[model samples]
Target: MTSEAKETGSGLTAELKELCQAVSEDFAMLASLHNKEPDAELLRLLRDERFPEGLGLRLVEERGAQAVAFMQRALSALPDQMGQADLDELAADYADIYLNHGIQASPLESVWTDDENLVCQDSMFQVREWYQQHGLMSTDWRIIPDDHLVLQLQFLSHLFAAGKTMDDLREIARFMDEHLLRWLTSFAERVAGRCATPYFAGIALLTGAYSEELRELLVSILDEPRPSPEEIEDKMRPRRVEEPVEVKFMPGMGPVV
Candidate 1:
């Protein structure tokens, strides 16, 4: 390749790396926010102009206009006449939705996946193994399950920020496809239905949409070059039909195939 072509390719790689890192940080921060009560400092951060514009605008472009509009409204609400009572109400909403017994929406992946709707099941252990494979061991494992929403998203942030190799990209694709993407959409939908505040509902929408967008982004990044003519013909050649077989289910694991 020409020097100019090489330089352009390198520049594009750098830009994509930076994009991944930025989105990773966004996910990490937002995930951390939902893990606890909203303090005054957290409220201040939300009201800050820098809080939403970058990721929010990008999400609008990728996801849709409606959720971003709701998100902006949530941020706008931050500066409104929120007295201590109002703040307490907001915090209460968070606790009721995320922390209460028999909550409408549990943030654990296994809860949404298992027939029993339990936590710390197979999916949780699977996610924990994936984390350890990537040099992450949960410091909160004594209290927090490895597959808590915050931990899962935090792990995704690390994956994206650290993803530069083809293997890294492939690992992320498998992890999301087999884990987070499997359950987060349902979890987000529940959050939208249950959350009293747009702050959290917007967060739900943002999390689901952003994960989807990143999955697509990684797919594009990992796209293979055109197949050889022989390979193309082999794929194009007609195959004999086979009888359908009975299938057993593996919850949250997609098709057994």
Candidate 2:
């Protein structure tokens, strides 16, 4: 390639990578939002402070006035500071929606996909394998299943942040198509329908829309169509019977034993 052409190609790749990273950050935040109640720091980012170059701002700009207005309404609903009563109320809502023995919108991938709607099933195994292949694992996998919504989103963020090769990007594209896209829209709908709190409901709506937008961006970068949910399920089926492999710890992933 000519020097100028090479430079242009490099610029495009950098832009794509940056876009992935931005989406990753947003997913990371959203994932954290559902995993627990809004803390002081998150409330500040959502309500008090401004991030001129932040993902939320960028989403509003790209997604238009409706998005801007929706976010404004959501932010307005959040308290500037959580008092004892507010925290307890949020905790109750979190449990009713996400925990407390049985919730309306279960976060496990298997629950959304499998006929039995079980946890720690084939989906969890496949997700764990995917993480191991990429030299990663969740420290909390013992307490929570590998295919929990938060962990899956965290895995995506890790992929975008760490990926440097076309192969890496391809993996990310496959992951989104096969895993997240299959169920996230429905999950969002469930949350919208079931969650009483405006905050959680807004999170569901935002996550669903943002993930779809991110997928579209990935399709453009990949220059190909994403696989259907059925196709993904078929492809993932055989891996379930495979023997589990020993996992290795990677640097910056966590502390080694």
**TM-score, predicted candidate 2 vs. hidden true structure:** 0.78
Q: What lDDT does candidate 1 reach at residue 95?
A: 84
- Model 2 lDDT, full chain set: 0.70
lDDT of 2 at 133: 72
| Alpha carbon deviation, residue 136, candidate 1 (Å) | 1.3
Candidate 1 displacement at residue 197 in angstroms: 1.6
Single out the weakest 10-residue window by summed lDDT for candidate 1: 1-10
Best by lDDT: 1
Model 2 lDDT per residue over 69-145, tens place: 56567667767776778767767877887776334688778888787887887778878888887667777666778
lDDT of 2 at 75: 68
Model 2 clash count equals 0
Cand. 1 TM to true fold: 0.77
State the C-alpha lDDT per candidate: 0.72, 0.70
